[model samples]
Target: MEAKKRTKIIDVLGSTSVGTQVLVKGWVRTFRNNQFIALNDGSTINNIQGVVDFTTTDEKILKRITTGACISITGEVVESKGKGQSVEIKVDQLEILGDADADKYPLQPKRHSLEFLREIAHLRVRTNTFSAIYRMRHAMIFAVHKFFTEKGFFNIHTPIITGSDAEGAGEMFKVTNLDLENLPKTVEGHIDFKEDFFGKETNLTVSGQLEVETACMALSEVYTFGPTFRAENSNTSRHLAEFWMIEPEMAFYDINDNMDLAEEFLKYLTNYALDNCKDDLEFLNNRAVEEDKQKPQQERAEMTLLERLKFVVENDFVRLTYTEAIDILKNSKPNKKKKFQYLINEWGADLQSEHERYLVEKHFKKPVILCDYPKDIKAFYMRLNEDGKTVAAMDVLFPGIGEIIGGAQREERYDVLKGKIEKMGIPEEDLWWYMDLRKFGSAPHSGFGLGFERLMLFVTGMGNIRDVIPFPRTPDNAEF
Candidate 1:
């Protein structure tokens, strides 16, 4: 006999064919009163209820149905006699696919703390909160590609292993094949990278911006969405050793055009989530509201998740120069009262997350695009302003986590870029090919990088960046 095709819990619940027969498979969320089963297959946040006749079904088989147990139920669809859901499965044939010893399973029917859930990250998605997040994550990822492709941008795959440090941050995970336990050193006592796999030193890429910019030289509009590694030794809620980034490079665009694109792109993504992932968003929004209520009243979110997303989509971002922001920060209540953790004492001070959040959540009451940052603080390739004091750089600040996207207009001048490279102490040979873009035919190109995890945090209302990613690689935690 041919095997029965399994119907998804989402489809089963959506059907009006009350007497239609179907096969459903999912992990049991709960086995209530030994008759009703709350089943989910990660299709949606909500679960499909399965009703079984306890009097007729074998008690031995019923005993195996517990929380986290995988089961296949062949039954007829019927209108739910319950309140929460409209339809349920009437089980005629039930089989335990995988029995979960209720006592051994990490997940329970009750609400599990986020901190506790992180310990079992592998099984966390089986729960309602994480299942919703991963589903929404898929929608966001799809929307990212959809948005860029619709904008006439060619998607490019940049290499993960590279020789040059794009950000000049100096913190990178070196890619190698040489036996570390053994020894290979040069006469200078430095590890001989020349003898390594790549014949020269190579590290996991920190940013695909530099490489994608090369493609922009010919493609006119190109973007890269891929993993980026940073070996920064910080284990903060916001920091991650490995994260994904979405970078778009345009050959003829300037800083102003970059800002406009960033705003539109963000709005498009949030709108996509609102439209495509409404069920998941609604669950996450309620979760955020409940989470917020536990916090001190003054420390709670001023706007709920849905409202926050709408604020970005419905309103124009407030744009100002870095100098203007500095002046405002200096005179602001937090700075005057010495409440800021990092006081705004100078014009060239790097704006931290606190400062960025202040500009967005408190001062502007809307998303803000900050431009014209001090040249010294920004990347070397950023366009040098006429005044020679700042660069044509811009950072888009959102309400919850502050800076979500950072970009700048490229310094197209060969001499100027070369000078900035030297001044920064970066080897000229390391970026010889990058300089060639300027040498051959460089236009006033511009691009910005949106941290995918940070965007996920804002979209899902998740607190830690680690929770937003499936397997978070932090400072030392790489366990599966």
Candidate 2:
């Protein structure tokens, strides 16, 4: 005789087939009234109620079925008498595969703070909030691949370690295999990088945009999704030591075309979350409302989660140049009243979060695409405009998450790109291969980078960027 197959709790709870015997496996969410048990397998937000005949079951076995305990049950599916759920299981056999000590388990049946959960990140995924968030994250990832695949974009895997700084930010985590205690020094007392692992110098990649651009020159359209590292010492909620980035390069795309793709990409992801992860989104929406209630009236969001998502999908993003945005900010009430932390009084000053939010949420009441930023503030790879001051750079600012996407029409002319690189003081020898791309059959190309964690924060309505990422690598915090 063969054994019956195990059914996921999501399937059994969703099915209407009564009187069917099914094998279910999951962790106990709650054992209520000693007769009912709420079980979940991380499949869906809803849990299946397991009716246990406590009179027949041993007292010792029932005691072990506390919160976070793993269990397997053979039961008959029946119409649920509970109000919250439609179907439940009447248990015939209960087996405790693993027991979570009630005294030792940190995650009891209660609403824990997000900060507390971050401390116990190893076990946080079992909670409803994180479970829903991670599921939504998965859905968004699938939607990203789906959207690109449908548009005939090749998914390229870029290297994790590189010998060049693509962003030229000078904030990379150095990768070396040398005796640091007994250092290798030059005649001038400077560290000799020639003896390093890569023979000169290498570090964890800050961006795959450069490598992916080389791929696009051949594949026409390609994207890279991978981890990127930064060695900044900031401890803010928005900053991370390591993060994931999604960079897409198009061979013949101009700045306008790049803006179109970025807007469509964001809208597609938001709509995907609404359509595929409705149950989770609803729970998160209610959670966000409750969280906002604890804040001051002015700080609370005006629109609900679903409304915000719909707003992005339904409306066209406001398009303007850096000069125009600066004008609006300079004349705005915040600037006149000295309310802005960094006053937007000049044309070349970089826009801060407050300014971006004001433009997107208050001024236009939608997403905004700010373009043609001063070349000094942007990267060297961006196309230098004829004005000689600004580059063809664009930033897609969302309602809450400012600068969700950053990109530009790449500088394809060999002389222009080489001149910009030299002016920026980047090592010409390190990027000789990149210069070769321009020297060869390089077409007019453009690309953008989307911070995966920031997108997650926007979609999940999470306050902190740390909360969205599973294992956040923040300054002074790397707990498992």
Candidate 3:
């Protein structure tokens, strides 16, 4: 007899050509009644049910069919009489690829806490929750490239190791080959980088904005989607030692243009998730609803996951100047500012997360774009506004979370950029190439960065930012 070809669980479930022999290979999620098996291969959130005839099957073979064991089964596809599934497998052959002791396995059939799952990050994807989260994670990544590609933007691979501090945040992870025990020293007793790799101090890039902007000067529209690192010691749920950023830079675009792209890009991705990851989102939606029941009423999200996604697509984002937002925070009807628990009177004060939450959830009741922030609070690359105190920057805020996306129009003038670099105490020589762009053919350019995990957090309705990414790198947690 000719061998049957392997079929994915998703494809097999949707296949109308039933009663044909097909090979199903995956890890066993559950074995019940000594005759049924729940199998999944990370193809989707759902599993394909395998029905075994225990009367005819060997006792030794059945004993080895435990949870977390890898197995291969050749079965005939048939219409499922069971609920919640379309098709199932009638097992004619069974072989255990690997055996996992039920007691020794980290994952069993029962519900596992997210905290416990983090310890076994390698195996978390086997669960329905993480499988759905990752499927959507993949869909979002594909949608990002599709959206930009359809808009004539070229995807540029930026360097992971860089010699410049693009954000001037000074929270970068340094990269060096110098021995700490016997380091090369300068005449002034400072560490000498000239003798080390790159012949100068370098670090894992905090952002690819600088390099992508250079591509934008020539390509007109370019984007960088890659891993970035930060050496900050913040152990909050919102901070990560390493994360992915989607930064798109465009030439001849101002702050207004930047806002337009940011809004469109976000909506595109959200709508894409709704269309592509319907089953996955439905699972996550239920997951979030159940997770919220354990939280206090005041801490619960007002909207469900699906509702939150639609909220952004169905509503228009409110745009206002930073000063205008502060004014509303102080004088809005119902006295939202009075209950803010902090002063919003200062003109140059950085808007905290609470302030942003008020604007999105309480006051505006929709997404909000706070624009033209005070220059002192923004990066040095942002275009200085006409008032001389503010920069042409904007942040896109969502209902559940405050700031989801941030961008700004670049400072095109060489002298202004040079002065800002010098004023910030950044060595002008470190960014000589960046200065050259401004000196030669600098044009009005703008870009925004969407933290990939942040978007995933909102999309998946995951509270901890660590849960969204596969292998999270936090302050004190780097295992697996």
Candidate 4:
């Protein structure tokens, strides 16, 4: 009989089948003394260390191989001397699949800055940190589907090219096909929208809330998990010109239900990543902890990836209305001392990132749901509260990540929605279909859009939004 194939790192550790032969294929992460090859098969989060002797393998072949080269080998699973791991592979036969030039390749065995890695985004995934992050991102996508599908929510696909601005922020990236040379110009020397591809102005969607709302009214429960774009020029670590958002719309739900769903969904995702991506999390923990130790003690005291996730899983999130949060900020020591970058003075002003981070991380010390924002500060679609000044909107702020999810209970009353639309200077004719939802059979509906990349940042303890995503699209930095 042919020799039994080698087992995977995950299976070798789990099974009682030691001293068995296995076949493995992976890229060489690192090589030591021309004897051991650190192999990762992409089958599991951890790589298997393959110890090979040059006496058995051809010296010419072994000398030709280098870092980042793909190889296949047959080996025996044996006990390892590695500090953290238990098993390693002793290889008998080896084949080099690809050759990577040692001098030309950008990724060396040593550490590289995040900024430098981002410059080579195409090749960064091969690194340990990025490999783990990308895998965690994939796991989160599965968790999102699993969480919603288990709850009987339908996954709906909204249009990418939309005619209406969902957020009314006027930050849309326009979709146009009119030639620039002999452009169809009006008598006033302005580009004519009538000559555009869509005949009217169109843009890449900023949010799918409005489209999902229409579907929610029909499907009862629906979600749009896709890319959203904005043309804002801000270059903060948190903001991306294009990002992924998971927007779930539910029929017959109020603002309270919206908060509950957001909390539950976030917890579900955190739990999912903790359970499914243990090895990846372990890799991330080692790196983050090492980096944290080099920082000041005060900064290092913030929650680790595992600890933050456990906190979310174990505790019930604190929920506060915008008015109550304002009162707390008014009476708080941070505001009194003027420690934050932006002041939290009144209820009508939008909450700054620093204030939101302070409330959740410093004061609350956990995830906090801030709801019932000022009507004038929020979008026109939000339901007006009984106080007439605040809208039934909510933003879920985590310890390190502020405003991971933003949503609201939509206004279902036709006349009220119409009046607000008109007063907000939004062309009433554009939202006729939205108003018709209320006229026909609109029920109390609520939903939230969780920035998927931001959620990944929360899961991986990644400091920036750009680091979590594969190919970040920021203003003036669209290099693929």
Model 4 residue 376 lDDT score: 85
Please tell me which model should have the higher lDDT, number 1 or number 4: 1
lDDT (CA) for every model shown? 0.93, 0.91, 0.91, 0.86
State in Å the error of residue 316, model 4: 1.2
111-164, model 3: which lDDT tens digit per residue? Answer: 899999999999999899999998999999999999999999999999999999
TM-score for candidate 2: 0.98
Model 4 per-residue lDDT tens digits across residues 162-208: 99998898999989988878788889998899999889889999988
| Residue 469 in model 3: lDDT | 94
Q: For candidate 1, give the lDDT.
A: 0.93
What is the TM-score (0 to 1) of candidate 4?
A: 0.96
Clashing pairs in 3: none
**Where is model 1 more than 4 Å wrong at Cα?**
1-3
Say which candidate scores most in lDDT: 1
Q: Tell me the lDDT of model 1 at 112.
A: 92
Residue-pair clashes per candidate: 0, 0, 0, 3
Which residue pairs collide in model 2, if any?
A: none
